[model samples]
Target chain A: MSYRAKVPKPTVKRLSLYLRELEHRVEQKQPTISSRQLGDALGLTDAQVRKDLAYFGQFGHPGIGYDVTNLVDRLRKILGTDRTWNTALIGAGNLGRALMAYGGWQQRGFDIVAVFDQNPDLVGQWLENHRIRPMSDLAMLVKERDIRLAMIAVPADRAQEVADRLIAAGVRGILNFAPRRLDVHQAVSISSVDLALSLEQLAFQVSLGLLGSLDEDDD
Target chain B: MSYRAKVPKPTVKRLSLYLRELEHRVEQKQPTISSRQLGDALGLTDAQVRKDLAYFGQFGHPGIGYDVTNLVDRLRKILGTDRTWNTALIGAGNLGRALMAYGGWQQRGFDIVAVFDQNPDLVGQWLENHRIRPMSDLAMLVKERDIRLAMIAVPADRAQEVADRLIAAGVRGILNFAPRRLDVHQAVSISSVDLALSLEQLAFQVSLGLLGSLDEDDD
Candidate 1:
């Protein structure tokens, strides 16, 4: 049984970043890495990296640093990425198709087992290896494939409708790409990717004339 | 001149959420909103909402609540969405096209002034209203349009190369859709949307069997 740790959300996010950095190190055939080295790569301080890792467990040695292969395995197990997860995609539009074609999800062990769309024109069309199915088939497919996670890419107006259906079909996690706030039940986890929010933050910084000044000091 | 506040990042994110909720309220013809009502709508605590808004300044009186029109205008100005920002898109693939077609950006005052691609086949294609130009013309167009913000939706392998070129062309802020960690100078602000990271976090919760129990307890 997996016991829950009281890991802060920020720490959880940092762990994901660490896992990504470790994957890169593994690709480069680096056998070990110091906290400073890993921190430098991700723009974090060494103390912050060590502190974040300490929340999980003790890792690395006093002088030799962390064993790359062993730490990677540990992180994968901790993050639950060592096992494959079957996911359902709920829209077949441009955003949905782009997500289906994204190589990163499959590379990191999340598989899009089925695709669903509301439009009859898109139904039965092939996307990658999976055929686009209709919304009517969602319940049956979720049960048959044991899909507990879903990705919502429909228009903002339809996002809530699709989410209601997914939750009713027993999906417990949703990654929403539509720029809308979803009122999901407490038991369900929903992460939203608001593209406009990011742009607004950037705009706020630019408005303050805070961008492009770092290189000036260096020069 | 726009003054930067020492607001926490989480507070900034919540402000955006509050802005979205207020927009919906406006659409529904609701004029004023209390902190408790707004908190309940967004799954945040009333106290938390009050504290977050307090970072900016006083919004509502003790009992009367906030005027929706005033709050929305204040948020827009604070977030820099009150003014239009000309932005450049550096990849003309599916993700780029989806973002170009996203109506929320235009509604919130971000205009995709130019589109760029390294692929010759797509260079001359028209997306939305902007023609896809070659990367060689990025500097000239950025200068001509005074574009300081860019969005990168290129493949992971080419993301860094495109980012380097964007920086060299005098772009200061980037909203990267590519699932890769970008290395940039401290002066440039980059926000990344890694789809896999969200999936992995969901998988971790699912693995721990932490789904569907909250509502049961609540009920």
Candidate 2:
């Protein structure tokens, strides 16, 4: 499952979806699953599922389909979910706390090891299990804990500043919940979960009288 | 800009992006913008931008490009952000509170008119200005307030339950934050914002050393 060719971003995302589906099947004690079954569950076509999985390698037998356990392991390894990633959370506000409280991240191998905030009042407080650290401690904690990923949940005006700090602190990737576009160096990878964007999409469907027909799976 | 033809989902999402870019240009008091400039700012191509905008309707002259204000207004109308949409929030937990605190929704036309929770303790509490109501009152609020959209921020186990209630209460569109697949009838449009999916996408890039090169905008 090593990366030999450039996989399309969409294919990579579908791989994550397939992994989730496969995990569910494994939980049900299913021995193997065909591409058709997987597609039906996720509202995708079987050929599309096969095409996405092919980006990694030949997965399962042609007629018998994919062994649930083996495919799960392969997809997990390909997705890098096989190993735990230590992450840092910046901005201990409501959004940040909600993200921290989300249990899926831990289940999928992302651990929020450190929490940081600029407010003096929140700096000494404990959120969940982690003590809120000051902004000055970011670089040090990133180095000491070897945190390569960070989540930004700051205000729009402060998103770029926190991103700059995270980048300078040696974070390679960031998942931003802030509603502002962040300008970053080429080395830093950023993904934003824009709640407004999703709502606007829903609004478009509602306006067009297409709300009932459109199927969406992404949050 | 009425729905004459079915717009592709990807185009609809990009329309939102175009509106955001145009709003930024308007704030700067810029009078006009070409497709190339808009595309560059959002990591899209000039032709792609033109194609997306074309789905709604023609804008600007061929040689002069689009007027900033005209394009913004057209996009806003096409995306249904021209008027406010009344919304309801279910589940008054940390995530629900965080969503209530988010200012972008109201800024971009989605208004949270009512908040509901099943827990008796949270039922009487106030989140922001809206007094939290019990689940029993959802139907009444939906009808009285004309709330066409609902946001579900409950725990994963409770997400489906709340979604059913919202649908039963006559909510036409839903934005679910709970990290699980929701089964709903065809008449209800639902979109999920899976934080785990976004993190896994980032993880895939970090693992493959492609984090720096992959450019992603939502579909």
A1-219: candidate 1 lDDT, tens digit per residue: 453445444555566778878988999999999999988876677887887788668476878899988998888887778877789999998898888878877777888899999999999999999899999999999999988789999999999999999999988788888887777755576677777877876676565445432111110
Model 1: what TM-score? 0.81
Candidate 2 at A19: error in angstroms? 1.0
| Candidate 2 ranges beyond 4 A from true positions | A1-5, A28-36, A59-68, A212-219, B1-5, B26-37, B59-69, B212-215
Q: Which is the leading candidate under TM-score?
A: 2
Q: Show the lowest summed lDDT stretch of 10 residues, model 1 chain A.
A: A210-219
Chain B TM-score of model 1, please? 0.87
Interface RMSD of each: 6.9, 3.9
Minimum summed lDDT over a 10-residue window in model 2 chain A is located at A210-219
DockQ score, prediction 2: 0.47
Candidate 1 clashing pairs? none
What is candidate 2's lDDT per residue for A9-83, written digit by digit as tens?
Answer: 556667777887889899999998998998888777888788778877756687899999998887777667889
Residue A111 displacement (Å), model 1: 1.5
Residue A41 CA displacement from its true place in model 1, Å: 5.3
